[model samples]
Target: MDQHAEATGRTPDDERLVCARCGATADGPRPTWTFSMEDGRRRYFCDSCSREHLRAIEGRLDSSWW
Candidate 1:
């Protein structure tokens, strides 16, 4: 990876992630972020997406993922 790529740590794929719950996005992803299934789907979550699977996320809804 280029130094700039290593420094800022963003890639084209980072923008491809859509939240599993709100159908939106989470925070920026790591360059090597891989896909994982939590609720038995071929999808992923931004930080806010945890609302669907994690009670803590819903309990802490006041917290901003942004």
Candidate 2:
């Protein structure tokens, strides 16, 4: 593991996640962020966007429907 991964307990992939909703980028794992799998692809959502669509997310709705 790299220094950042060891320090943050995040994989290299986690260091460059882009929010599916807002395009917000994160360099580390965020406790409040959300991760989802859609159409066989991985997706991430930032805290604000996740909160904004909490209900939809809880309902298992796709981001497109939110």
Candidate 2 segments exceeding 4 Å error: 1-15
**TM-scores for the candidates:** 0.32, 0.74
Note the clash tally of each candidate. Answer: 1, 0
Model 2 lDDT tens row, 1-66: 344433333446656756777778777678999877666656778899999999999999978898
For model 2, the run of ten residues with the poorest summed lDDT: 1-10
lDDT of 2: 0.73
Question: For model 1, what is the error of residue 14's alpha carbon versus the real structure, in angstroms, after optimal superposition?
Answer: 9.4
What are the C-alpha RMSDs, in order, of all predicted structures? 11.5, 7.1
lDDT per residue as tens, model 1, 1-66: 333322233335564455443555446663433334333334444444453446644443322332
Evaluated at residue 41, the lDDT of candidate 2 is 58
Residue runs of model 1 more than 4 Å from their true location after superposition: 1-15, 26-41, 55-66
Report, for every candidate in turn, its global Cα lDDT versus the true structure.
0.41, 0.73
